[model samples]
Target: MLELRPGCECCDRDLPPDSADARICTFECTFCVDCVDNVLRGVCPNCGGNFAPRPIRPASKLTNNPPSQKRTFNPDCFPASR
Candidate 1:
């Protein structure tokens, strides 16, 4: 099961369970679209893998399979200027 992490690991942006902005690597290292497109340049800082849009869990299923409350913030993952 996907952790459906609650926020972008790079920018700490809020990415709710259903947010289309969420992108994740094969390892499920989550980030926002902005960070993936601009800052990280389609690369995952943690795993050095390409990112794909995270699948949104259905609202009905969310009740049974809750999204993770953990927020992984790695401000140093990329340069701020990028």
Candidate 2:
């Protein structure tokens, strides 16, 4: 199952379970659309793989399969100016 991460790894932006802004690499490295387009240019910093829009879990299923509360912040993954 996808972790459905709670935030962007690069910018630390909030990405709720159903956010359309979430993007993830093959390795499940999550980031926001802003960071994926602007900072990463579709490339994942943690893995040299391309990113894809993260699938949103259905609201009904979220109760049993909760989204991950753990956040992964990696400012060094992108430029400091971001």
Candidate 3:
């Protein structure tokens, strides 16, 4: 199951479970569209893989499988993994 991470790993932007702006790499490293497009250039800083829109879990399902409360932020701006 997707972790449904709560925030952008790059900018620490609040990415609520249903946010369309959330993008994720294969490793599920999450970032906002702004970071993916302008800052990261379509690349994931942690995993290097190109990002795709994170799937929005259905509201009904969110109750059963809630979004992750754990926030992941990488402030060091590490190079992309790939």
Clashes per candidate, residues 3 or more apart or on different chains: 0, 0, 1
Residue 53 of model 2, lDDT score: 91
What is the lDDT ranking, best to worst?
1, 2, 3
Q: Which prediction has the highest lDDT against the true structure?
A: 1
lDDT of 1 by residue, 1-82 (tens): 9999999998899999999999999999999999999899999999899999999899999989999998899989887565
Tens digits of per-residue lDDT for model 2, 1-82 = 9999899998899999999999999889999999999998888888789999999999999999999999999889876565
Q: Each prediction's Cα lDDT score?
A: 0.94, 0.92, 0.89
Write down the lDDT that model 3 would get.
0.89
Give the winner by TM-score.
1
Q: TM-score: which is higher, 1 or 3? A: 1
Residues 1-82, model 3: lDDT tens digits: 9999999888899999999999999999999998888888997767668999999999999998999999988877644662
The parts of candidate 3 lying over 4 Å away from their true place are 78-82
TM-score of 1: 0.95
Q: What RMSD does each model have against the real structure?
A: 1.2, 1.4, 3.4
- Residue 1 local lDDT, model 1: 100
Residue 19 lDDT in candidate 3: 99
